[model samples]
Target chain A: MRKPPYPTVLKPYGQALLDLAKEREEIVCLSGDLTRQCEIDLFRDALPERFINVGMAEANMMGIAGAMARQGLIPFVHTFGVFATRRPFDQIVNAIAYPSLPVRIVGFMPGVSSPGGPSHQAIEDVAIMRALPNMTVIDVADAVEIRKVVPQIVDLPGPVYLRLKRGEIPVIFDDDHEFFLDRAQVLESGEDVAVIANGMMLSSALLAAEALRGAGISVAVVNAPVVKPFDTRTVEAVARGVRAVVTAENHTIVGGLGTAVAETLAEAGLGRPLRRVGLKDTFAEGAKTAPHLFKKYGLSTQDIIDAAWNALGRTDSAPTAAPTPAETGEYAPV
Target chain B: MPSSTTTSEVSISRFADTIRLRAVMMVAPQGFGYLGQALSSAEIFAGLYTHAYRPGHDRLVCSPGHYIIGAYAAGVEIGLLPEEALLTYGQDDSDLEAIGTETSPAVDLTCGSLSQGLSGGVGLSLADRIKGEAGRRVFVLASDGELEEGQTWEAAMFAAHQGLGALTVLLDANDSQVDGPVSEITTVEPIAGKWEAFGWHAVDVDGHDPEQLVRALDETGSDPRPSIIIARTSTRQGLACLPEDADGHFIKLPPDLAEAAVQELESRLA
Candidate 1:
């Protein structure tokens, strides 16, 4: 695979967290045996007094984080996204989110970040967290943004669910870029079409934009890292000017960025031709390679390009026909 | 003995009675609650708040959150909450939420899922230890039914291995659960022995006796290991109007029997 236009930057979000732990004594970290994968080893080493390993118990880790928060300690509970979401969603909802505690939930190995196959991929985490009340859902696009956003989330006085990628993710944002918790950032501006993306899909969206640019279709890329409390204003404004809107996410199409953008547009009465490029309604089979899995789930760069073209009502073939409700089902309403 | 000491002891007993009365009032609104558990556990709750527990400092998590009436009663007795809050028990727009305890200044954790409280309690104890606040204790109240949860065992192992001596678990071995008797569902017989095997300093005692409960709590300090007090209690100790076999898990007193049960409790108190 060819590298994108951005330089390969080794941005360490977890190391920055370790540095923050030096001054903030109230910051306690908990891991469920994912220390190496989560890159929180430095924090564990530096602050042995505050770091706790709850074995392989994710549910207990959540409960521990909640109780620690109650005692005026800020706990960052780290684990894989699947374990954090499916294994302990009830604890997250009742113990952490319901009480609005200052517990930072770091869901590592999000969206194919783990090569250990389907069981490790966290494609549905956003859907689970966004449905709950008082939960701030965030998907960091790259390491630079993750480091910038981590400290800000600690300061915010509520439960924060931060999705982090494992290992060295290519840096998409510049160091000088000012990132906010709830605000959307427009990386590139154009009037032809708007491409909304988050997480690893942000890089794909940017790549798809370049591919579209070569083919005479101007596209704008907006990085919406925060899904819950989404930037509806930005979505509405951009949707009005663009010919069609395409949403890209490394999550399932059901309740991730695609659903969030569609909901916003529908609510604002600006519904238009929109295409969502994400995982289909299915679990990862755990047999295929990561690249094959991405291709099969329609999360590749080419998939976004095809989706953008489809949204613009463009057909490469000779046959042109009217869309039918019977054929399209729910897509007809959109 | 000095007269002042005698007066203080009487006041403490009165405080325990106030907790029982507040719990009884809260249950009256719903027509019923875990009244047996509340009544049996009132004295222990009173002692914790009045003597053992340092309010606004230490942490206490109720594992079997269904026994919210007892916790509310303890809060009311200690003036942490008002007695009028009991009027909203099981009512709409009431802070007294059914099943799950609502988040309030008086409540430490919103515990409804069984076995979560012990894990949460371990977290608090670890936090206190990290802060070097060794005097602060983390108390968790677990019901007999809660032992069925695997997470409780995980927390038990965790607390014991960490040597969290400041963490204390009080088990209300009422021998009752939702389906039927705890033994029928899953026998937790020899609970004290099981806890001892798990590396805790286990103490089995009559849950209803306030003096025994206090003594057991005092002994916990002497042991370096985390403590578990297996409180032997009855499912329906105070309200004898109901049949002994009547399941106290979710008591549904008919309208006609409600007045009789209340009258019986009043006569017992008198």
Candidate 2:
């Protein structure tokens, strides 16, 4: 993982959207009274005519987005993660996903990222979006992925659910990083343990891998940003090459990335030892900080290391805690 | 109504009868379907398709899936769909589903789910406006029962707030839903005042009266606000074949009843 002093970009999603909208006249942005929160203010300021503040009506906003897509207008509907996926699920299914419309559902504050408790935290968004047919699900890791993802998914040929982090985004990947909609990147490959992670958990998995490498336990680290069109060959290859596998995500273990990998492995009949590191079938409480929720919800670097240790059946080899990276800025993946 | 998706060569009193007759023909084969919905919404379909709908220009957003029987009938009358297609309604592997779906032909977007059509109407209209084609129109055929869905009001508030003048909602105010009469379930009465309160040009009209429907629908963009014609209708508007005790929401046409219903609609058409 990149150390602190990692340059941060504020509202990377908003900037990317604004930049994209400038090039594509058919791109329209809609906010459900979450204009600045979801970070489309830049687009609104630059291209006011293309932006719509659709009030707090999430369901109506989804229907409107679907209808807009039918007219060849790419509508990016943004809101807090919870309202974006759950509250308007039926609308998403009926108007957007059902007909395979090309509306981009941009949801901010994924999982325990929000301090607004269960109401604001989109703990189950990935699962909800993953379950829908014709929905391309993505959870971008950093500024690079966000910028690349916004433009790439525009021509996805169907609806896409994009899970993003608000505020200053960490620059995990380099400026020239390439992102594919159906590929998972193997950050570091090792033989003993494979850690397939995405979103906020990628950094933690990297830190865990670093500590495991130091402990003489080889670990493989993979970043799976796209969850639905899950790169089965990559996931299977990574799992097949490792003694045990660990799936980490900033979401509930059920029906999310973990479940996707689990389904893939089981279908492929890869009887690899698996451990999932995420919210363990539980709702997160309101906390002052996301790291605190991560630590409390068993989603920290230490937890990933412990899960790896547990998966490897190394009960005697007590897992060591990797130095928790100093949250150098206002936002840092713990 | 250049909703761009209607495929309507767009109806009259005779057109209204044509729609009712087609609805019977579609449902008769199934022996049961949302035939009552088709009956109640027949004239609203006829009035809009005859007076407003323009094929390859106008779009029709059918929110209530059950009303497709009437819509398909209107489609057949407009020559967009084959009349023979009605016989295949509810048959195996038919696109003519008992309830409208995305595959349902003729309409722009067909949702069996309630109250979603209005939002779609707003979206279609809003999309046109965003694309600098604000004059392109959409006629949304919704059910009164869907007013119970919160999304209906949400769409209402948005459409009116946006001044979607080209969007016309022909609400079939048939006082019946699945549970019995809509008034008995959740009264969406004072429906006009309700829409007006939401900033719409509300007009309550007789669903069966073609003249009233034409006038009400014509006022859609007359004053630059979204227009709604709440056509008050009944499940038995054009069908006298059903027994007095028949369900007024979804009708079951067991062979004899189906035969009788078809004969009655044919007689009216003749």
Best-fitting candidate, measured by DockQ?
A: 2
- In order, what lDDT does every prediction score? 0.78, 0.86
Each candidate's fnat, listed in order, reads 0.69, 0.78
Model 2 lDDT per residue over B1-270, tens place: 333323332337678777777777777776778778877887788777777878679888999888888878888888879988888887888888888887788788888778888889889998898888855778898988899999999999999989888888888888888888889878677999999999999888888877677667777757688888889888887788777666767788898887887788788767
Index of the highest-TM-score prediction: 2
RMSD of each: 6.4, 3.6
**Any idea what lDDT model 1 has?**
0.78
B1-270, model 1: which lDDT tens digit per residue? 123334434444556556556555566656656666675566667667766777777777787778766777778767777778777777887777756565443557648877789888988888888778877777888888888988888888888989999888888888888888888889887898888999999999887666667778889866889999888877666566667676668665665556766566565456
What is residue B39's positional error in candidate 1, in angstroms? 3.6
Error of 1 at B170 (Å): 0.7
Clashing pairs in 1: none
**lDDT top scorer:** 2
Model 1 residue B42 lDDT?
64
lDDT of 1 at B62: 80
